[model samples]
Target: MTSDPEEQVRLQGFGEMTLRTAVATLMQLAPGERADAAIFRVRDDVRLAQSEIAELASHWGIEPAPNVRSPGLVPDQHWPDVVRGMVREAPLPSLMVAFLVGMLVARR
Candidate 1:
């Protein structure tokens, strides 16, 4: 809530860095009894952060973009099914992308 624009930008940058660090730490943790708990904690934190960001944006008169989808695109409600179908249609490519993402995240 700093009035200075530079301070606000710095704070936002720091928040992003912190979130990325948390995700990187989570990725490094070995899978075990604790991993599920950690994942849930991160998920909740992310949800909270998202809500906070939305509130802040609204306060600043920044409206979110409309959810516009082109013709033939799957509806928002059917995203899960669409993703499943895509994976089913191209499992190898999906897996490769997933692997590459994991590697990139780990590198961070």
Candidate 2:
């Protein structure tokens, strides 16, 4: 299949990087409790993924995912700081693994 260049992402490398990290977060959460605080974190990552994808998709005149938050939600002081910190301080997938380990160990 031919790749569509118009659909390619070029501008926000950070978005792509964050998405890769979010995927790992999701996989790690698959077997866990929703009550665990990290599940909320995973949701945040998922929202970030959606937002980045939406921003990219919007330029193409496509209808982005419905659940994607308003741009304001992220660029704000509280959320953006944490999100950026997560991207900068740690690899998302690895963080999820550590979160799961901590939760599992704590339960024992």
Candidate 3:
């Protein structure tokens, strides 16, 4: 919320850089690790909710869904490599897409 356009652009660039760095860091993590992290976050959230609503905790005995492995065109393990290859092959298009997404998110 700055009056200066240059300052706004600088801040936007910083935000985009931070987002890109976070994405790159996540991409470096193994798929299994990512899944585990997501599960942990959900577990923490559920624990917090249960703590806040003690009476509802008893009703929240939901079972986890069974893991059904579906055959994908590209196997799970190679996904990160394939995505990296795609971005390497078409850097400009990827950057444009990222920029557009950032703009849309910023507008919101």
Candidate 4:
């Protein structure tokens, strides 16, 4: 299929930025907080990470939309150590996880 090079490039850039934004947002929310966005039309890595994040939260009893999240939609802290521990100890999604790690490292 013939594709517009410019449009495709723009879409790719948008996708990368979206992932970066999500990582940044989640880091700001709460420690070891799990956030999930729609899987439909999102990047494979994004969908996978959200699913993993949800699972990880459940495993730790970190309920989603918890009392701290107000409407309980967002994370409450970076919880970097918890996230870092999980990332180090388990096989988590790569792309989003790496972005978040980079974000955390950059912050330090």
lDDT at 79, model 1: 85
* Superposed Cα deviation of residue 47, candidate 4 (Å): 1.7
Candidate 4 deviant stretches above 4 angstroms: 1-17, 35-46, 50-108
Model 1 TM-score relative to the real fold: 0.26
Candidate 3 lDDT for residue 92: 92
User: How much does candidate 4 score in TM-score?
Assistant: 0.22
Clash totals, every prediction = 0, 0, 0, 11
Model 1 poorest ten-residue lDDT run: 2-11
Order the candidates by TM-score, highest first — what do you get?
Answer: 1, 4, 3, 2
lDDT, candidate 2, residue 95? Answer: 87
Error of 3 at 56 (Å): 72
Q: Which runs of model 2 end up more than 4 angstroms from their true locations?
A: 1-88
Model 2: which ten-residue window has the lowest total lDDT? 34-43
TM-score of each prediction: 0.26, 0.20, 0.22, 0.22
* 29-99 per-residue lDDT for model 1 (tens digits): 34341134221122233232434443444555555444445655744558888878877888697789988
Error of 1 at 26 (Å): 23
Global local distance difference test of model 2 = 0.40
